[model samples]
Target chain A: MANDPISQFQIKNIVPIEIGGLDLSFTNSSLFMVATAAAAAGFLFLTTANRGLVPSRLQSISEMSYEFVASMLRDGAGSQGMRFFPMVFSLFMFILVANLFGMFPYFFTVTSHIIVTFALAMLVIGTVVVYGFWKHGLHFLNLFVPSGVPGLLMPLVVMIEVISFLSRPISLSVRLFANMLAGHITLKVFAGFVVSLGGMGALGIGGAILPLFMTVALTALEFLVAFLQAYVFAVLTCMYLNDALHPGH
Target chain B: MFVVTPAYAESNPTEGTHSEAGAPGGDAHGGGAFPPFDQSTFASQLLWLAITFGLFYLLMSRVIVPRIGGILEHRRDRIAQDLDEANRLKEEADNAIAAYEQELAEARKKASAIAETAREKAKAAADAERSTSEAELAAKMADAEKSISAIKAKALGDVDAIAEDTASDLVKHLLGGSLTKAEVAAAIRAASGK
Candidate 1:
């Protein structure tokens, strides 16, 4: 609301309720996270409540998103990978809804926090580990070994693959968190200019037009980034799950 | 105005108070503090994320996804059924066209047979009428010949009389006096090449 660009990310306690010794207070971020999840789920439920042969506008949107996720999973990981559709689709919807909600004036961006993004990233990696081990046994270790390599150089290659495999969550989490955080910060900073400059006079208002235009353009870009990051996350999950499904490759 | 005003006021904060409240604890992050990085808030955010995400996962898997999938499957089945119906209709149309063409061809053959018999009847009637006309003309030609012969006979009888009269007149004209009837008769006989 004010020129403090970072204040938008401030997690103030909305409803203070502490458990035994662990503080379980509901904050603004928590509220938005719950809201995002609800909104994503509610949108589908409402739109698809009454099924149709020829879909309405909202029905078409719901169907299109469903097909889009279905096709993405099918392409990334074959037909067998569809078993994990709920998890991957939920993850995608949650991130997408959270990112899009952040674009609103006062709504909080849940993806901007490293903790939130990291936790989701860990969930993806954990799914890969558990599923891979459960499905393929010791062959899951083959993920850290290259397919076609000489025995002499295999050890060095294995170490590099292990590091890369371990760093997946770090990169995945930071990519989303950083993009959302930076985009929001830049938008807020420009928005701050619109307010401060408009306060001055007619000339200040005229100058404020530049930052205003920039904010508009950046918001459009952020929208693209929102959809793209969600897509990237889902596709990567499918790819990781594929490795779990077929370990050596 | 009553309903709309509060909604607007809730969204837009008066600048002085918002920034003042924001200033006291701008932390070590950078130009302004982002409270998400704070160690204290992590437990709550994580806890809520787990709960809400778990609930969302459950809701989507149990209820929402299946409905959409069923709709898609039903639509696919409908499209396939429609295609099958279209194919059946096309075959029926082709069969109808073939039947119509066969009927048309049979009708054409029957029409041609009727036309041919009609043409033959007209030709036979014309021939019969022509032969009858020709026979009538021949009978009339025979009758005309007979009548002409009768008239010719009458004319020949007059020719003999005329010759006799012409001979008598010639003798009278040549001589000063008239001859006796027997002498005249004898001269006539001689002139007639008796």
Candidate 2:
């Protein structure tokens, strides 16, 4: 019972609330989300509060993250995409901080859930669609029609393009969701192995060493995935935003 | 950290039992769906995610992004200004060096000119002094020659008179005869002439 891996992902209510028959109770998920936002915002605000010409250690970190996202956007979306800098930066920092927060034991991984990731993905895709239409009107549909497709296969190619385009949100959301979920489950399972095996005698303790090592290794890998997923998410967001900015190609 | 997970699990034994027992026919959260896929908590999770993410975006757009961006922009401007100042100072220094070199060259030229004029003046003065001394020496030599000629002439005149008196005395002593002064004079004159 104490070794149930799935229990960690349970959304236990912290402050149960009933409003209009909707279950908007603040759960552990919400707590971690709030924590992630606070950590990200608070760190940036505090570190750059002084706004030194030469940044301090903490300040350097803040500046590095800023430059990192800025350059990522500039590269992925070009100069025109700079208008979306705030959104892209916000997404990047939120995911990065949330994923790091999830790395802690007993902490809820906000990104581990599909609905949350889907919402975030939809936010990006929605921005792209709205902004694309608003900025370029129906011309944004040119994205589905490749410029060099032959006349006969044009419809077939566009159909493929449309299907692929629709899959962007799903892939974006699922990639992060699946990675976080799978990594955490794997880590938990191996950790469970260590516990179950160690419960036996000295022979079992010796046998548990392998899973213990694996668990340790997996934890390190999970940390990498945490940071990597955040980066991939931000990069993909930039690319999608790029599509919105220049939908023709 | 590992210890914390088990302790956490122990504290939430209900959730653990619920998942294990109700894997087939899970209840609200655990009966049918995985915890992440559980539709029951979707609204709440979405609400909080929206709330926190929206606030985060606002903070970033309103305060944080601008602040960091301003810092970067300010640093870039400062560096550019510093580089400009450095270039200006270097140009000024180069100009100063050029001016100093030109002044040094001019001073050297002026000094040589002064030295050349001084040398010419010294040489001219020496030549003038030499010519004046030579003129004085020539005048002195001419005067000495004039005086020597006069002395010679006077001695010659006295010698003539003495020679005549001596000749008369010799004739008187030799012949015991007195000759007249005019005759003696004539005789001496004739002798001189002969």
DockQ-derived CAPRI band for the predicted complex in model 1: acceptable
- iRMS per model, in Å, is 7.7, 5.1
Least well predicted 10-residue stretch by lDDT in candidate 1 chain A? A16-25
User: How good is the docking of model 2, by CAPRI class?
Assistant: acceptable
Screening candidate 2 with a backbone cut-off below 3 angstroms (N, C-alpha, C), the clashing residue pairs are B26-B30, B26-B31, B27-B31
Q: TM-score chain B for all models.
A: 0.58, 0.65
For every model in order, the fraction of real contacts preserved is 0.62, 0.71
Candidate 2 ranges with C-alpha deviation above 4 Å: B1-32, B148-194
By DockQ, who's the top model here? 2
Model 1 lDDT tens row, B1-194: 23223533443342223223333332333332235575456777889999999999999899888989999999999999999999999999999999999999999999999999999999999999999999999999999998899889988777766766776777788875677666766776787766
Q: After superposition, how far is residue A48 of candidate 1 from its true place, in Å?
A: 1.5
Candidate 1 stretches greater than 4 Å from native: A197-207, B1-34, B117-194
DockQ of each: 0.26, 0.40
